[model samples]
Target chain A: MEVIALKKLKVFLAIASSALILGGCGLGNLSSRPSSNNGTQLTGHANNSNYQSVIKHGHYLTSKSRGVDVQQDANQLNLKSFENGLLDLSKKEFPTNKYIFQEGQHISTKTTEHWLDRKSQNSQGLNPSGKETKVPLYLQQMDEQDFLTQHGKHLKLSGMTVGLGINSIYYYKKKKYGPTYKKSISNATVKAEGHKIGAKVLARLRRKPGLKHIPIVIGLYRQGSDDSLVGGNFFAYSVNKGSSIDGWKPIDERNYVFPSNSGDKGKHANDANDFSNFKSRVQNFFPNLSGVTAQAHYINGSLSGMHVNITTQFYSQTEIIAFTQYLQTAAKKYLPSGMPIDITVKSTEGVQSFLARKSGSKSFSAHVFNSY
Target chain B: MEVIALKKLKVFLAIASSALILGGCGLGNLSSRPSSNNGTQLTGHANNSNYQSVIKHGHYLTSKSRGVDVQQDANQLNLKSFENGLLDLSKKEFPTNKYIFQEGQHISTKTTEHWLDRKSQNSQGLNPSGKETKVPLYLQQMDEQDFLTQHGKHLKLSGMTVGLGINSIYYYKKKKYGPTYKKSISNATVKAEGHKIGAKVLARLRRKPGLKHIPIVIGLYRQGSDDSLVGGNFFAYSVNKGSSIDGWKPIDERNYVFPSNSGDKGKHANDANDFSNFKSRVQNFFPNLSGVTAQAHYINGSLSGMHVNITTQFYSQTEIIAFTQYLQTAAKKYLPSGMPIDITVKSTEGVQSFLARKSGSKSFSAHVFNSY
Candidate 1:
């Protein structure tokens, strides 16, 4: 009886040990089991052991690993291997390095620019100056799609300005100045009117959709030997986004100190030597305008910042009627809901109010509906 | 004299020992030293003794000094340290793996039928039963791009023989197959009048300076009804660099097999049951066309591949000429230099001859050129 009991006990113990081992192996129906950091048992052919090992190794490196070892591994992997491993690791970890990869770094701008310059220099094996020719075939190939695909997302069109110029003038004499003096004065006024015309032409671009986004810059320079401001020339372009604009902030004392003329010896210049104070002031009136700064210098005459000023003048009676009708038609076409057109004339003196009514005929004239 | 000599010998030995010890320290002169697996050493900052010791201890699980125990240090460093160390070692041994990271893995299909089925099912929010109202949008997009970009690179037409019904026969006998049919048949006959059309077309494509290098592929499909052949359709496209006839071989087979329906009952029948004979003939003529395989079947018709056969024969000759001309003109305009046009044609007696001429003048027929 004693021998039988001992044999039974041994058998029971053996079975219990076997069960424990199986449980540890995760094959037994037990709740508690050791988790493997690198290896685990799974059922079926779908459980790819090699793939699991790779995943486990990757996890081990990223979470429990240090940067020093990672750097070492990065060094160890060949270009292809490192790229593959990084890609695999990234999938299980970050999944995408787009956030980490610097934008615009993949495109080598210097190389592209250099190639463009070389092509330009060759001028399709034509003359050195590349003048009086059709656009380069290579450039023609660079349609909107090519530009957009290559640089659209990375491009930031900031701080750009346009330049204005005039070659001739028109003028009217004022009765306040005497008749004998009026002749010489009228001549000067005519020349200045030409420059004003140029300025007005440039100003009209503000209404054009494509040009509206670009800041208009004005610079006054002599074209031949004209004393009138109307005969001056101007130039323009956008400022690079990387530069600081704190100096060009609109403030009382520094209002006239536009940041232009980048390549000029004068202060606040643009690289192209085209930016000026007049351009900056006109650009400022545009509500949507941003990133405009300029520099200015007197070419053939002296004009202090105070003397160089702009005054908003009111429309004449004839002009008022034409503009009112134009506005009404435009409003009707663009604004179906309706809009308000306030015709107020502002001058250096003060403000005047009048009601502008459209004449029914094609040739319309404006009469003062009311006066104030 | 003996004492002086002993002193000199001792000094020399001391200097040699010091040099060996300094070299073993791993902190060589920074300015002239080469970069290690870790990184480049900065000038005047070569005293990286601590870093070197840590790296060595991490790698070997032992200390550099004779008496120091490093097992505890190794344990404290953990998996991160091991990973970093391993990475460093790898970098020293394998540098190429650093840049080429894997983006991701994808399950790709060699044939379009599975893609179409899966796509259709997905679009309808249910598993497809082999019959769908229309091809999926994504499939359409792919097909559009393939048609445009891979024109001459793969077969793009289907062929079949049509039996005229009694009513249709009477209509054709009276009105010459109606106005559209009359115009189309005349155009086809005119285009196919000379055998040199193919060669001239090839030469014209070669003459295109911009398309000198592009590889052209022409796909041919036969029209048949009850195993009786009719007219054929030919289309062309170009391939991008590095992709060759090898890449499109399967597509050609798929094109013929999927577009016809004759052998639907044999034990070897598959989705491509209809055009088995056509495919075999295609393979025979253009052995390299083995890769141009596709699987097609008719869902509603009593006979497989029957609809395509009737459609091909129903179209008039003028329509075929117009279609071929459109494809050739597109190729002439867009492809690069040196591209060959792959031509596929189907006829009642197989592709005996086909004619094509440049639009406007019958004098310049493609059949007159024979460099092929």
Candidate 2:
């Protein structure tokens, strides 16, 4: 029995030695690996204790494209929203409580940059050729965040989520510090192209050895233009469990800006009417208000959320308190219930008060900035 | 008021005409003049406005009494003055940079609680009797911050500062979850009672085993209620030398919520014209602004220091750099320059850049949090 045990130990040591030798000559796959990273497989990466602890910074892992993506990202708001919103979607599928977040080690930054390039002789670009004036650039940036589950002492990759930041308007200069030219892409074209790219990308990603069996979520975002105040929203998404994506799920999202300006309130008539009535009530209470505007969000043609921005002429704390209390009453009386609504009243100086309600909650809580 | 403004305008015009001839070659220093400070002593317990390197947390400390005093110091904010404001009263007698900050060792949490309770049987309470409804439970919370100066082998208490959190309005319910009944205290009575309490607390603290001669500062604060959007300010403070109370010095600290809505022509001829003018100039120069607001600190009605928070609409580093530069010029042009003026520009995600001028400095210094 002792001799057999010694033999078994010897055999195990031999296997480990051979594996180490192969790993030592890791340069064999170096060319295929990502920059700044050792090309560590998602399953083979170091265990991250962050997921088990309180998630303060966020659950999303730092990708190889983190820095470059921000630099190439279209605008400030979209740049932030792209990764954050993607994390929000991924968390819904793979919660932080159950899974650990890891950067997508499978795809190299060079590979993503290649896919983001124009389809030239040497580049396998995801964007259109220079001849296609209408769609100057569709794919702005690609981000990947992997979710892993702890299995004993090792971390096993549970799933991966991909974010595609597609551009609405591509602004480019013919030369450095030269006149700028822009070409806009329609939302329909962006959606169609995004779906096509998702399937192709899924097929390509599945070809990678470690990713064949895991689930993948691909969120397609309509990135904001340079002049857009707010970031764009995810227009569609696709989730595939085993190797291939079967079909895409189009997200029915719409934002009704300043509903009072819309002549035909459309299917969002109730939301538009409610928002308009709330604005009027506020205006009636405080005629000194500079303006009261709102953007109501709809999902599947149903009101999901609304954000009201109130620019006020009053600066006193008493006035702010009175108005906030009055606004809360007005919101409850005029605005639709059962949806999250946020309102911020501001003087030219800055935000004076903030009022909001949680989804399905009856009452709205308000805070007025203590003014002196 | 019109006559005063006319006379002031005549004086301002006279200064402006002469300033153009001499100031063109004489640095073009054109911000508003401070109101009453004819350059006071730093050692004198006046307001200091130098702590604006870090931003984002509101100007006041979020208390933790289940959202009350020092209890809820759950996170961060470095905005509070050290060798300035009410602290300067203590700090002038005890230089802070020479000592190390540590939690107070002498006072236990239970002891402070006893002192906060109403004077009653089985309790050594410091508050006035519950029978006096007019001044009932005026002392709400107490905070202790200690500084230790390193001695040869051990640390010795260099100084101690006690914050008296007095209630402006006493809100209570007869039973748990019952309707709250509020008993408001007049400022005059609060001041009288707070001064009386300060002497007793100082005498009690001085009797502690090791706190004999070390300077102790007692700051009487008028705390805001649960309904107040902003936290209360320290109104008066007394700096003691050796176990005794000196005369209380009033803190004429006023925080103007950036600019008032005194828009160009004031309804009541608002005196916040300088700030409004500055805001308008910055807004007009850079149309891409989310909003800009400030909390300008004044001591004895003089602009001692100003903290301006600029929220940008764009996300580009180049635009931020340009805006910061433009803002620096605007700050020098529109704001009072003699004070420690600070400004932080932020996107919704986080801070992007900050610009500041140390008190008595002629030029501004700036830094960007991220290059991209």
Candidate 3:
């Protein structure tokens, strides 16, 4: 009996050691293995290259997009792999000794099973099929307040706890000999929780003492039937706290869609340049205007709203009317059809706004905030 | 020369000592005094009874009002007197060694003169004739975040720095005398700086060894020409921050005109009881509804917006429409006519909103946030 027990222990040790060695080498096929708990199989290159690419794409997506799809429990294999990918990326990107991505279980039995089943059946996770679900991403010791102490103390410490989880959909493709699903990282949910994740990532990077500044990106995912990649959103937390959160103030995340790629110019990379151009165009049309500034809001990759703030030397009702007309025309010329644009004309005397809505033709409705 | 110098010193010491003595007794007529700077006269009864009453009224108003008036530069006398009254009240109520009302030059010269001049001329501070201006209230160490730490750590801290100020018009008439232009407290600028005065008051209280909890009120003055006394606004900070401020997330302060007095009774009273009655009536009509909550937003004791959040076991479009109709009838019966009421109907399956804008008749517009 003693000899048999010794043999079993030896065998277990050998297996564990081999697994460690393969993991250390980073040569094992992560996708080939089945997730022990869930019967679902994960399909992805789950290697260094894949993780780096996703991280790179994550930064890109966050730079470009405002909000992303937060999905959880739909495909356990994909979810676990994707989570692993994020964790690996965080570790590599930050190289922090302390593991920020500590594991926890945050699955909701109410919506997980049903949502997963629906995902398997239907592609679009439409609202009509069922109520929009909230999935909790398991995180332990994500104390942003504590993290801020060790990190940049000058940085304003805002605590954010996310409620919903991210979701990704993959199609199963047969490779002649065996059935293997192809990984397609679709809608990764970007909300308060996602911002928390971004903050955590930033915290890890800044945790490496003396790292004063870290470039942060809000993540937004594409929501089309065929779109694959996610967009990086520059703005994360909203100007105001959103709905509600238990431990943190609900700060709504912001996203902006670029109009066009600035005529494929090498000089300008971000959408801010396009906004500047829009401002210049408005200013050129009305040369008398002072301090013209344009702000564009993008959802996914499409312009949802555009705001133009201009300061004039003096404001007149007639001049405002003419400017509103010109702005309506400019909206047609520059912005994508059916988008909302808010043009605020300000002077030392007063402030007025032209809220432009696109029907068939652009119509500018005006509101005077301050009387001249 | 020595004799004359000695005499002069003696005179100076006498005046200083008398000032200190009067200050100790709290007997100096604070109303008939000039604000140390800005060439503005302080008004109102700044003695104990008057200050206490105003403070009490502040707490009362805060407890009652939804959103209150924030005015500045319009009525210097009332504004200054109100400031002093608040300071005296804070000192008396707290009874601490630390001085909360520290003297500082907070008045901005940019808009104060123009605004004050306008007030002297026109009843309404209308622009075009002159600029309806903004006044900046300044302070050295306005630490709201620190104040939040000591007061209520769990309380969400939102800092709102108001650009415009508050104005309060007061009419003083003796029984014998006909009427007097008793100073109008116009535009007492409430911002981070103003809150500093509040923090200073709190600090004074907290500086004491054993003072555990301090009852503080963020004061909002009454706006209407006929409204008697100012109401205290309880929910000082908006749930979310409003515009921008230095060293803090911009939080907009909110004041609610509470519907009826929650009986400490006649000593403290307002219209919150009517709102409560309305809530009861609705619940009585629909006994099956779960979690029915009625929140009323009042400006200067008038209902501006009313929100009704209710939970139902299930949702039906027809049932919602019928219930909306019932609510419309109820609004007509109970609430003020032509006020905007937002009805958010929630169920286990979904949530729908019925936004009713009272025109000739109550028009109910519906939006489904979720589907069953």
DockQ of all candidates, in order? 0.00, 0.03, 0.01
lDDT score at residue B181, model 2, on the 0-100 scale: 83
Structural similarity to truth (TM-score) of each candidate:
0.13, 0.45, 0.27
Off by over 4 Å in 3: A1-111, A114-256, A259-372, B1-261, B264-274, B277-335, B340-361, B364-372
Runs of candidate 1 with Cα error greater than 4 angstroms are A1-372, B1-174, B177-197, B223-372
Better of 1 and 2 by DockQ: 2
Q: Which residue runs of candidate 2 sit more than 4 Å off their true CA positions?
A: A1-61, A67-75, A95-97, A102-111, A131-135, A173-181, A207-209, A224-226, A369-372, B1-372
lDDT of 2 by residue, B168-244 (tens): 77766677777868888888987898899999999998888778888888988776555432345678888888666
Poorest 10 consecutive residues by lDDT, candidate 3 chain B: B1-10
| lDDT digits (tens) for residues A1-372 of candidate 2 | 000111001111112211111112121131221121111121111122113210111111235554345235546667655665576678778876677566556778788778887786235777767654344777877778777665543456679899888877777777777877887879888888888777778888898877888999999988777765456778888889765676788777655566555667576776677677767645644546888877666778887777778898755333454466556655765778888887878776566667778766887765543322
lDDT for B127 in candidate 1 is 18
Reference contact recovery of candidate 1 = 0.00
lDDT of 1 by residue, B134-217 (tens): 211111000100001112221111110110000000011224344411112232332232112222223433453433454333
Q: Model 2 residue B54 lDDT?
A: 7
What is candidate 2's DockQ? Answer: 0.03
